[model samples]
Target: MNLGRYIRRTAAHQPDAEAVVCGPVRLTYAELDDLSNRLATALRGLGLIRGDRVATLAANRAELVVTEVALYKAGLARAPINARLGATEVAHMLRESDARVLLTDAAHLETARVAAPGTAVKTVLGYDGPSELGPGYAETLDGTAAEPVEVDCAPDDAAVLHFTSGSTGKLKAAVQTYGNRLALLRKSVMSADTRIGPGCRQILAGPVTHASGMPLMGIFFAGGCAIVLPRWDAEEFLATVERERATHAFVVPTMVNTVLALPSARDHDLSSLRQLVYGAAPMSPQRIREAWELFGPVLSQGYGCGETTSGVLFLSTEDHRRAIEGEDEELLLSCGRPLAEAEVRIVDDAGAPVADGEIGEIVVRGPDVVPGYHNEPDLTAETFRDGWFHTGDLARRRSDGYVFIVDRKKDMIISGGFNIYAVEVESVLHQHPDVFEAAVVGVPDERWGEAVKAVVVPRDGAALDEAGLIEFCAERLARMKKPRSVDLVTALPHNPNGKIDRRAIRERYWAGAERRVH
Candidate 1:
């Protein structure tokens, strides 16, 4: 069945049930279905057809969810722009995706107005107000019919232009087709022990436009409720989880760290949370263990990029318990085995599989994987080859089939001819009593060609220095793999995707150099 039909079926089953709750706004399944139908009719009135592109530049709000369902009903592709991006970057994405319509809230109407002219966007609708850009979002839907749309879309028809976080360079769009979305929904609902059915209530703590919204379709398909937070505040998050009895939540490592450090973190009654799915970057095992101690064994980890439609590998709660209770400490570092029907391989440059425990490029083939980039044919050819998508991440597969991501192929440190995975060094650094966060990078060096450097953020009021951290790493890692220089900072930089910005850290030490590496 099509994605639009999934929600329609849910609405028919439980028309009066709560479908979405974003702060003061609460929408029933019937109301959500009717509103989306009106918006779809309005979009069709604007001359948009089955294959048109519509972009939403908003945060985790009701309008964003409404727009998504509307896009599906209207048979239009969605290009969700990151709300954190600047106007120029936002404009670049709109132009790249060739979006025909731009939708923004009151706060972002100015940016949308400035960006709409530089692209093929012919209409700008404000979700909150009637700005100079166009008519109000509600006004646009007022005169439209609340009837079901009948547009037919093939399984392979484009559904979403999901843009990458772009920490390294320009952002690229992964063309997520209707079939890919269906695959994602299937895996989520069928994943054992998830309990994502009627009465399931998941919290949207991060921007729903990105990874936080990946599982939303499955939740809607299962007739569950989605509670959205306007912005992430640790205290508010904990309070919401307690007050709403949130059943599931999706977060990154950074968010978890912040929530764990809050003074009142333990005060909330979080017994309602059954699963806390964490990913978007490599989380230190030390932090994961701490989380398990305070939050019970509900923590699950997902590993996938924008190209793979959110998650292809899932580290289940059972795996986390094994790590906490078993003697195999190494299992804690794995991202977990591939999901059902998904295949992952660790291959060398020649595309040959590597031996167990040997690091190699990660390639995946699955129904959920995106077709290719939006408009870049050469890049698409290079990334998607031989029926598999070549993820630039380097990883190693354990004998038990669990995959341990070593590092991004570009982020690996080549120091004096020795290969150092930054994740490995950072993992050791996290074991330190005083170190709160650490990022390792390779900087320019005259004699050794490249030197291993570390930038760190220490715990509040903790006494830590460069020499002490270096000595601590030397005890845990190889001599050459230890950081040659360590700099204590208040906080490390983060990219738009909430991952540590290692490229930004390298730029400071490698300034004036012709290239990043020797």
Candidate 2:
């Protein structure tokens, strides 16, 4: 039931194949396997046993990927820390996960050292340079042999602790068992949108710690090259795609928007791209169309979260082509059908199935689903019940089995007894000629209980007024569904994972108000 054995097998078969690339650093399959083996041996020598936690706080780099594979080989659970977390939050996660050692890089070494003292973190190892906390990364790996360590692990043993992005509330770790990870690998290899083999290369533009990292194993298992960019810049990404002849990439909607807005976005020779997979947030239909226009029909959409290990449903490249060709106009807004061996249902408050085209909470049952949240029994029991994990997203299932996400259950705004979905309004807002991006939230209102407000960022050098924007929505939607007020801003705030921060937007308008909607 070991997942590490798969990589070792691939390394044996194709030792000279390119495995990972970042900047000037490139590693063959043999080199990557040996480095991970040495690191695993070093961790074993440090008294780390099966089931012990090892945390990593580094950006997208070769070492981050190496440490994750090494942890799997050592039969240790990996607790990947978000590189953007504050010192206090870092300490909280270390204590909560009870990590034995913290593996960090030069960028985050000082913060890791500051957070290690008051937590269960006993040692700190940096990827480069001297560390005040313990030893350098190279120093720790010097004495270990470049051979695989055969550690035994059961299918149900914990393999990875995936921390939720916390866009809604406090962060929690989803305990992805070894079986769950195996299921992820199986699903990914079978997906039409993510499958890759030798001579294929994929560009990773987002932080690999979260959604962007989901397909790493599938690529490795297929003997494809993973080109890692240290940071994300629209121009740099396009240049890389042209230079490396990248065949695939995974990105969020926000990154797509940034690239589309670039003046030279269409000038690059992106003919080699076969698939552009997008997720982590709902993209407006207008933006998706723009992306399809700019990138041809190479766009696909994947829908999942940290709890599902990887995408449970994928909108294939063919699906995108169908929508673009106007065969199924409504399919443009769908997140596509559930993948193989997975069951998806839409249920109401009492767990009853809703009629087609009606909204409800999405519940999923599959081998890739996590068993529960780590160390939180009550919360786990509430979420995982009746053999299904209840996703907090609200969606509607169409007659053809396509699912359309409406909004987060908690983010829905009720104004004057009518429910308003933020995504629905934002989608319409994006269609305006002068509008670049928009976010909708519920603002406090004494008369209506809550008012729908829009924070808009207009296109550069475009003249737009609130009256005109409101009129556009009013003509397209019912009067009640239109935003009551609009606040034009230069840019919307984004969380660390690159999703729009709606909670921060709500705080600006709901301060000191005690209004609650039941």
lDDT of 2 by residue, 114-221 (tens): 788878888788888456788888887886788787588898899989988777668889999888888888987886666899889998888787778778888889
| Residue 492 alpha-carbon offset, candidate 1, angstroms | 1.3
Candidate 1 per-residue lDDT, tens place, 227-296, comes to 8888889899899999989999988999998887887899999999999989888888889998998789
Residue pairs with colliding backbones in model 1 are none
lDDT of 1: 0.88
Task: Give the TM-score comparing model 1 with the true structure, all chains together.
Answer: 0.98
lDDT of residue 241 for candidate 2: 92
Please identify model 1 stretches exceeding 4 Å from their true place. none
